[model samples]
Structures are given as C-alpha cells and as structure tokens.
Target: MTGPLLQTHALRAHYGDFQALFGVDIALSQGETVAIIGANGAGKTTLLRSIAGVLRNEPGAVRFDGADIGALAADAVVKLGLTMVPEGRRLFPSLSVEENLLIGAQGRKAPGYWTLKTVYALFPILAEKRRVPGTSLSGGQQQMVAIGRALMSNPRVLLCDELSLGLAPVVIRDIYAALPQIRDSGASVIVVEQDIGQAMKVADRVYCLMEGRVTLSGPPADLSRDAIHDAYFGTAA
Candidate 1:
C-alpha cells in the first residue's frame, strides 16, 4: 500500500532453454500508467507474461498490492485483481461479443466500476455488435472486445500487451484514447507497446527495453529523444 501497486524485482524469464529476461525490474503505482517500449524480441511481451503469471518465475520476483504473485497461475493472478489484454486479441471464434466479455467476469467478478454497460459505453461500437461473433468484427473492434473482456473482471491492475499492433493510425488513436478512462476507473496500467510516440504520450513513466534488460526509464518529458533512441536500439543514432 505504501509502495508500488505492482512490481517486478530482479525478474528473469525463460522459454525452455532460451532466456528472455535478465533481472528486469519495473514498478507501477496506483492509478498510474507505465509503458514498456522496445523493438521486436526485446522481451516486452515476455515481461508482461511474467507479470501476468502466464510464465512462472521465482517467488518474490513479482509483487502486487503487497503480496508475492510470481508463482501463481494465470487464472490465480486474475482472481487477485490483475488481468491482461494480450497482444493478439485472442477471442473465441464461436462466442458472441457479449459472451466473450462475460467470460472475464466468470473468472473473478470483483465488485467495481467495470461492467458490460460501462465497457459498452467506453467502446460504443461494441454495444452495436454485442450479438456478433467476436472474431467476425474488424481487427480494431476485436481489440475493443478483448479490452472490454479484461475490464469486465474489474481488475486493480491491467497489463496491456501491444494494444496498437496491426491497427490503422486512427484506430490506434481510438484505442489509446480509452486508456485514460480505464485508469480513471481505479486501475493502474502497464502497457507494452512498440509505438514510442504513443507510449510517450500515455505513460506517466516509460521504460525502454533492449536485449531483455531495461536500458532506460524515466518520465517521458525527462527523457531526451537521443537517450530514448540509444536505449531502444542499444546504440546512439
């Protein structure tokens, strides 16, 4: 309660024999938005997965709201008020948009600001297509459903991985525009993004990852363009 709402301390991750992270540390405070930006294979997704409990790590590696959650399963993590909107917008092809959103509540319906109505209000298009199959919607629409689904659980911390991936610029703006409302709903957010400018705009603090380590981190205004460029690519441009 006194420190960060979510934190990863010396967090490392592996896929079979390949190591993806090396003692990575990041923190997010209540009602704040932190962005993780990096190029491909920089372990941005790996770091989100590690914190979301999709990839297990040593105990004490990830602490959330004063409890150690590194070893918890993905479902267990959701139950504890932490949820993730994954990169690909993994929605059920057979389920309707509303049904997909309902699935989030099935896991752990923590009483709070997010509900189907609130989610629909945030992304008005979702209300119109509530009866359609989730995958039948456009890429941007599907992403909305994915985010709505996560919010349905009313999480205290939301981990978003690649929210702008594969979408047009306008669609990307629409999606990013909703983040402030999400944060206003009383949830701290950690966004993993490749769009440096977008990340800089939304985040209270930005962390640049390169080669699986944090190369630079600070408030966006406090970080120079040259510093970010060097940190993102591991060399000065």
Candidate 2:
C-alpha cells in the first residue's frame, strides 16, 4: 500500500518481432491518478497492454505490490488486484448488465470492497437497466457497464483506456464525475486518454509518451499546455 502500487522498469513489448515499446519506466502510488496521453501510435495502449499482462515480457519488467508480474497471464494479473477497462467498451453481448457485473468478481484472489450494490449506486441508471443486455445500452451506458464490471473485481489498481472515446460531451462528463468515487473505493487509476485536456482535468500527475518513450511527465499544474503540446507532437512549435 506504500511506495509504488504498480511500477514498470525498462519495460519493453513486442507484437511478434516488432517492438512497440522501448525501455519505459513508470510508477503509480497508492490512491493516485495518473494519465497517459499521446497521439495515435504513440504507444499509449501498448503500454497499458503490457502492464495488464495482455503482453508478456521478461521478468522484472512489470511490478505490482513490489513483485514482478511481467510474465503473469492476464487473469493472474487480475487476481493480483489489477484490472483493466479496455478500449471500445468490450461488454458481453450475451450477458445482462447485472450478469456482466457479477462475473468481474469471479476468481478474485483478494478481498475487496466493490460489490453490485455499490456499483449500482454509483451509476444509478445502471440499477434501472440491470436486466437489459449490456450491449443494448447506449454507448455511454455500455461504458458504464464496462466500468462497473471492472469495479466488481475490487481491484487495487484500475487501468482505463480511452474512457471518453465515442461518448458525447455530457456523457463524458458524467463518466469523469464518477472517478472520485472510484478512487474512494481504494484503487489507484491509470487513465489512457487521447485528449490531454480531459486527462489533465482528472489526473494528479501526467505522463506524455511519444514514439514508445516518455517525453514529458509532471504534475498537470506544473506541466503547461505548451509543454504538453511540445511533448505530444515532439516539437515546441
């Protein structure tokens, strides 16, 4: 619970022979929210995938709770209290919203506070639509299910990829509004966002990645828009 809850040291990844990530170092403290912002192909998702155990690496690459998890499988990672709300709101088309949420708790190795009731309370509309198929909900509602499902696992660290991708402005606001509650539920968050502004609004600290390497990192307040812009695009101009 102290020091870094999750960390990566000289982490690298490959899709077959093409390495998408160079040596990367990152850290997340307990209860902190950090944002990963970069353009398309800047290796943002690759980084998340690597940490979530979706991509395997050499030992000592990915660490959680001070233990290396680089070679662990995805389910093993989840059991260790790290879960991801993947991009595209990948809800089960056959599962009802409630069913989807329930599955997140299956095989959880550690005790956690999140449950179906609190998830419904956080997103009240979900309580009303619990019986509906998760995929039938609107994009925003589906995203809610995806998030609720992840929370049901009661992860200590939550990795969210593109939470606002295709949602409307108001819907996006509604989702971001729930972040404090998510934090209160005892999970450090790493939100991967294409929109730096949204990331800045929600993150305690920000890291900008470009071409597989970290370009800039600091408190959102300390890193100016101009600085972020330069790091994001690889030039001050």
Candidate 3:
C-alpha cells in the first residue's frame, strides 16, 4: 500500500538458451498508466510475459500488492488481480464472444467494476455479436474483446501488449480512447506500444528499451523527443 502497486526488480528472461531481457526494472503506481516503448526485438513482450508469470523468474523478481509473484504460475497471478491482454487477440476459436469474455472471470470472480454487462458496454459491438465466435470479429473489434476479457477479471494491474498493431489509425484511436475509462475504474495500466506518439499521449510515464535494457524512463513531458529517439534507436537523430 505504501509503494507502487506492482514492480519488477532486476528482471531477466530467456527463451531456451537465448536471453531476451537483461536486468529490467519498472514499476506502476496505483491508478497510473505506464508505457513501455521499444522497437522490434527490444524485449518489450518478454518483459510483460515475465511479469505476467508466463515466463517464471526468480522469487523476488516481480512483486505485486506487496507479494512476491514472479515464481507463481500465470493463473495464480491472475487470481491475485494481475492480468495481461497479450499481443494477438488469441481468442477462443470455438467459443462465442460472450463466452470468451466470461473465461477471464473464471480465476477471479470476486467482481468489482467489470462484468459481462460492463464489458459489453465498453465494446458495444461485442454485445451485438455476443453469440458469435470471438474470432469472427474484425481486427479492431477483436482487440476490444481481448481488452474486455482481461477487464472481466477486475484486475488491479492490466498489462497490454501491442494494442495498435496492424490496425488502421481510426480503429487504433477508438481502442486507445478506452484507456482513460479503464484508469478511472481504479486499475493501473502498463501498455507496450510501438506507436510512440500514442504512448506519449496515454502514459503517465514512459520507458524505452534497447538490447533488453532500459535506456530511458521518465514522464513524457520531462523527456525530450531527441532523447526518446536516441534511447529508442541507440543513435542520435
């Protein structure tokens, strides 16, 4: 209660023998939105996966709400009110849109601000297509389902990976437009985004990564465009 709602300390991750992250440290204060920005292969996704418990780390690597959660399994992490909307909608091909959203509530059903009704309201198109398979929706609509599904857990911390990937600007705008409402619901957010301008617009703080290590971090206003560019590409621009 005294410190950040969630944090990673000296976090590192690997895939088989290949290391993807190196001593990554970040934090999310309650009700804040933090953006993790980096180019391809900068270990942005790896950092999120490590924190979400998909790639287990040392016991003290990830702490959430004052508990060590790095070693816990993904489901266990979710039960404690931490969730991730992974890259790619990854919806259940066999399940209806409503059913896929309901799946998120399976691990943590205590309920807070999010539920089937609220999720549908957040993405009304989902309501219209509630009985249809989740995969049947358009790319943008499917992203809404992914976000809504994660919201159903009523998580204290929501980690979003690449919400703007492969979508048109208008659709991306609509999706990013939902972040403020999500923050108003009392959930801290961390978005891994490739759109630098969008990240600056939505984030309270931004962290740039290069070669698996944090190169820059600060509030958007406090960081200059040139500094961000240098940090993002490791070259002056």
What's every prediction's RMSD, in angstroms? Answer: 1.0, 1.3, 1.1
Residue-pair clash count for candidate 1: 0
Q: Candidate 3 overall Cα lDDT vs. reference?
A: 0.93
Best model number under lDDT: 1
Which candidate do you rate higher for lDDT, 2 or 3? Answer: 3
lDDT of 2 by residue, 1-237 (tens): 567988999988888888888998999999999999999998999999999999988899999998999999999999988999999988889999999998888847456678888999999999999999999999999999999989998999999999999999999999999999999988999999998889999999999999999999999999987889899998944
**Which stretches in model 2 have alpha-carbon errors above 4 Å?**
107-109
Q: Judged by TM-score, which candidate is best? A: 1
Model-by-model lDDT, in order?
0.95, 0.92, 0.93
lDDT tens digits by residue: candidate 1, 53-139? 999999899999899999999999999999999989999999999999999998786899999999999999999999999999999
* Steric overlap count per candidate: 0, 0, 0
Candidate order by TM-score, decreasing, is: 1, 3, 2
Runs with alpha carbons beyond 4 Å of true place in candidate 1: none
- Residue-by-residue lDDT tens digits, candidate 3, 111-208: 69999888877888899999999898999999999999999999989999999999999999999989988998999999999999999999999999
